[model samples]
Target: MLIQLAIIGLLFAVFPLALVLISKEQNKFRKLIAVTLFLTFDLIIFGAFTRLTDSGLGCPDWPGCYGEANPFQAHSEIKAAETLLPTGPVTVAKAWIEMIHRYLAMSVGVLIILQMGIAWWKRKSMRHSPWLPTILFVLVGIQGAFGKWTVTMKLQPIIVTIHLMLALTILGMLVWAWQREATQLVLKLPPLLPRLLPFAFVILVLQIALGGWVSTNYAALACHDYPLCNGEVVPQLDFEHAYTLWRELGRTGSGDFLPFSALITIHWVHRSFAWVVFALLASVAWLSRQQAETKQLGNAIFAVLLMQFMTGVATIYFSWPLAIAVLHNAGAALLVLILSVLNYRVRSSAVPVS
Candidate 1:
């Protein structure tokens, strides 16, 4: 089943590989890295849609939908589940969604393989370090492991969240690669801005984890509206249950209700953290706009932040609409990717060449 799924998945690699194959450009390697990053970004977006829609376990199996490569063979099983519970997590449509996500992931894995191959092939002749692509290959392997764990564990929140983080990490790495490709120096140091950029990156990562936690726990609707949650600015919370890391998928450690306050706490904390995240990122973006090398990047970060802020509100006020929620996740990934580029460029460009 895994082999078949991988074969089916390789279809996605055709276009990008084709571009590298027939391009008239002298430096196909750099273009290949950039294009791979672009496609991987799209995959991360679609993966968000899959998880948000509760399609992670649509197939109820790994590498295949009910021992079949495509959802068609598993139609009977899917129909059985849908008939049993019409709107439950497992259904025909969801099966398709999950399978598509897997297919895209496999395609990306193939591309990464090709990238590493080419990188090693031209190791001595290449201007940039070969370890760049080599490291990407390792990251993709770790990502695949988490992907399997996500399904096998039945979409456990921590596992799923880890998978999400891995995807974003891969995006960060690829963006770094693209920056290296954009310039001749892979080891170039970037300018430091008040020593606050890296500090912001750490905080942003925590915020992202909190947001993912909120999503995985289905706590987004706990507060329902901005500035107030359950009609209180800071309602009574059950942080004990909310922060219990080793609990089951939806229940407390003892298999009880998990506490309503836990949900509120989860939602409220993420909401509060948003204020900090927004203010800090906005500052970083503004400061970046003053520099020539990072100005455009800062502008791009601001644009993504706008999209992030708007989509977040739309998700809440509009009742977690699929399009808006998916866009929110994509915006988060883009924000992370941009910050990574900024971090690398800021450090790389600022280094003194002696």
Candidate 2:
């Protein structure tokens, strides 16, 4: 089964590998990095879709569906499972979603391998260290491990949240690499701007973690109202259980049914934190506009910030439409990308290409 899975992964990965190998672009390395970055972005979105559709356990297995490489081969088993439990996790539609997500993940892994290979192959000619690709290679391996844990562990909130966090981290690392390869002169910013950006980045990271908590815990509609939670400005909440890090998906650490109050706590924290993140990011965007090189990025930050706020409220007001919820997740990722790129550009020294 594992060997067959390996072959399937290779087949999926081959298309991107061939594109990179046959490309006529002047800078093959940069082109490959860009393609990998784009694919990773798509993977993150698709992952959100998989989660939103409750397909995380579609196959109820890791790396393969019912011990088969593809859903088609496992259709009989899947149909039997769905027949026994019509509303359970292993429907034919969901099996396909889960398998497709795994295949894409495997393909991204192959691209990272190609990146590391090429980085080492041309190490001496390159201005950047090859270790960047080497590290990404390692991170992708760790991510694959978590993907398995997410399934085997039955989608525990902590594990799923960590998996999501790591994906964003991987995306940030890729953006950093892309900026390094496509170096352009960026104007110096005020000293305070440098310091403030990192602070804002930290805040954003925390907010994203909180957002993940809400999603993984199924707390999106806990409040289902704007400017208030459950129609109360200070809704009753169970913080002890709600914030417990190591518990099952819908149970407290003590194995009790997770209370509605706990879900309220989860939702409340995320919504409240958004205000702080939005304000700090707005300040950063405003300050960034003072410098010519960073002006466009500043605008991007503000635009994304607005989108996040609107979509966030829309999700609550509109009762969690799938598209808006997914976009909210994507907005968080775009926020990470823009901030990481801006930070990298600010710190990097641009040299004339002689």
Lowest summed lDDT window (length 10), candidate 1: 184-193
lDDT for 76 in candidate 1 is 91
Candidate 2 structure quality by residue, lDDT tens digits, 1-354: 788887887888888767877999878888788788888888998999999989999998877888888899999999999999887688999899899899889888888898899899999999889999999999999999999999999999999999999999889999998888884784667666777888999999999999999999999999988898888998997899899999999999999899999999999989988999989999999988887788999999999999999999999999999999999999999999999998887767522122
TM-score of each: 0.93, 0.96
TM-score of 2: 0.96
lDDT for model 1: 0.84
Give lDDT tens digits, candidate 1, residues 1-354.
767777786777888888877988777877787778888999999998998899988888887888899989889989999999888688999999999998888888898888889888988987777787888889899988988888888777788888888898888888888777666333322344547788989998998999899988888788788877768888998988998866667888778877888988988998898889999999889878876666888899789888888988788899999899998888888889889988887767654323
State the C-alpha lDDT per candidate.
0.84, 0.90
User: Which one wins on lDDT?
Assistant: 2
